[model samples]
Target: MGNFIMGKGSRPFVMENQMLMRHGLITGATGTGKTVTLKVLAENLSEQGIQVFLADVKGDLSSLAEPLENNPDIQARLETLGVKDFVPRSYPVTLWDVYGEKGIPVRTSIAEMGPLLLSRLLGLNDTQSGIMDIAFRVADEQGWLLLDLDDLKAMLGYLSENAATFRSQYGNIAPASVGAILRSILSLEEQDGDLLIGEPALHVADLLQKPGEEGMIHILQSQKLYLKPALYSTLLLWMLSELYEELPEVGNIDKPKIVFVFDEAHLLFDDMSKALTDKIEQIIRLIRSKGVGIFFVTQSPMDIPESVLGQLGNKIQHALRAYTPKELKDVRAIAQTFRESEGLDVAEAITSLQTGQAVVSPLDPDGTPMPADIAMIYPPKSKIGTLAEERYGELMRQSPFLFKYEQRVNRESAYEMLSTRAEQLAREQEAEALRVQLEKEAKEKAKKEAKNSPRSNREGITERFTKNIAGTVGREVGRTLIRGILGSFKR
Candidate 1:
């Protein structure tokens, strides 16, 4: 019960106004109960009719898919908070795992994914990332579609093999750039990138769907995927890009299509190149119109990119380890972010927070940062943590997603065409080698026969002799030229 006091009756705190769900962040050290806090907010928001997209990196939050249980502690919290008639409700939810272990297969076409995001996934440096961008551009121009990793590899191979040809049309591609980018792709492939490259890329609609009267919650299984930080980050950013691209502008709706919570968010921004960082900033800046909100979950407020950090209007700070000077400094920084109530000692409160308690600072209407309050977060009504593996699978098989991405499709994508062409070219080379081999064998056989039987050359030489009967005059010219030169010298 150390951190589990933020309940309904503990304090008066506004969780979030659905209208201001532009973007937000939930950050604290491990054991500070970020997951529980996220659950409380998501459940409350979903109850208020907002869709939620939760990336459960630890895979412990799948219980959101199940109905909430009745518990005395929950009832006590609600009663203490002066609230009555609290009912446990389950939100509509779909489980998503990039590895396809838990949910319907979510895939994105390589063309739609494009190179900008893939570059980050591959961890390409500036030069290599540029080369990748060029590859995507070239694919677009040639009417080639990239549907998977193989297609991308083939496109790169084609470009490298035909550098001169591509140079004439799309400018020069240096061998060095191509090599670096290819190496990055290989590194990605070694991580079993096949999971990332396939049809049925996650649909924004799937994330947004809320059947019947219940609000939808999307739970992404991110434990294994998080091991590849680059891929993990890129996958999230790509989904955001897809949402931005796919969803129409809805201005300020009552609720967003989905609330995207990026736990362990520092991985997304840390070690990213400037171009990739800039694109993230752009997407974060522009995605609000698409009716989605992004919440960064990390250890410290500093984990967020400043560009992105500046945009998060809501802040929920739990306890921090303020032993070191640097950490204490972070605590001070966290305190200053909120509008202070005189004598509230926000920094002191941050260091003193228990497991379930947080120094809450949600934005009010008019975009103004509200004063910090020591607020008690409510407990989730659902069973927390993993459901049975068999149960997860059963849900997917019987899911109502009939027309969604079940089909393993083969389009005129880069993979098929390049593989086909490679096979064809290999066959052509083999055929040519066979023809040469046959001709060489014939020549050897003819020579062997000629040596063994003199008649074999006699008939052939006589025929050659008959054709060259006029060839004797051609040799006489050489003799005439020498004689003329000698005669001139004597004269």
Candidate 2:
């Protein structure tokens, strides 16, 4: 799929497969063939047997699985480029979705997402983020695995209820902050964040699968996901982080083991916290050693940070509209990035470049910068637009995870564990109350018996006294009578 596109002033233009691991960028205004270039690169990389993972924000890349439709313009371009052996064909593809509507559900554990990313996903404030971190810490200490949004929610509730105890060890977890975090999480759930956080989490190995000569193309269906920009960006970043953390170091390989294309790449940085932005920059700078290449697709180069832009060795810049002064300035800055060529006025060329044309600068065989050239991007052999919903379903049915990821696995995580603990605690409190009540009743009955026994003892004492007095009086009278008779006789 990666052959010579055209002769650039008698020099053949090509994207060397070996230097692809160095990473790349694709920038252009809307309707300027950015999606087409992305498709071309994806198809070619897959042809080279390199696994490809890309987020299809507009659902445009889904058609890569279908044969390119015949178009007169495509034929003319092929003829103009003097390509005789060009055969339109489809590549192997697998579809995935967080929502489970368009493809196999792709999910990850809440712990895998971690508090930092989750905070970004939920758009939590600093205090709320701090509370979230505490919640995760509490969950970890309690041996509770957070596998879903509900798990995090339950953990937050648990922490709020036991805030006093947690404060001693973890720090103050304000109920207001906890509530804010919970509300944020609830908001995310309303946005279908529940579908993204779960068990049987996506295995990184699944993405590295190359079934045949052509690597498998895993396209994340992101039409609905794109609505939540934070979630969308965080999802891709987490995937990148996972790949970086999990994959063994394979420094400077012949080619990339996997290629990740982040479309609408600006969303990953917009409103992104400084710490997170630095983290992302660091990942982009270092993950190349893992034999993974990241391509950022966006509207303009300004959307990318300077630190990130410096690392992108290969640049494919599509057309830009310079209606405003700032846009023209941006165009000039973009033009200056290319290596100087004799008569190639990059600024002018950028505004006038036709659709399917781009200013490309890929690395050479010796890891040297190839002089930038204006080249007509080779048309993708696969379909250029979205596949029908029925067609999309048909392809999904053939995926390896047809039934595996379809049914969500709700393993006992923080949610169920905390819920069970709460129920158990309530039962224990109830039992304790019952025991106390029983003990109180026993004490009251014993007191009543003791009080009655005292009265009975008094009654017995009085009766015995009366009896003794009567007996003594009678005996004394008899004795007295006897004594009186004796005394009278004696007298």
Q: Who wins the lDDT comparison?
A: 2
Worst lDDT run of 10 residues, candidate 1, spans: 1-10
Q: Could you tell me the TM-score of candidate 1? A: 0.83
In every candidate, how many clashes are there?
11, 0
Query: Residue 224 of candidate 2: its Cα lDDT?
Result: 91
What's the residue-level lDDT of 43 in candidate 1? 79
Cα lDDT tens digits, model 2, 318-377, are 899899998889899989988877778888988998888888788887767777778887
lDDT of 1 by residue, 198-229 (tens): 77666677677677555677777787888888
Q: Which stretches of candidate 2 lie over 4 Å from their true place?
A: 1-10, 454-491
Candidate models: Cα lDDT each: 0.74, 0.83
Clash-forming residue pairs, model 2: none
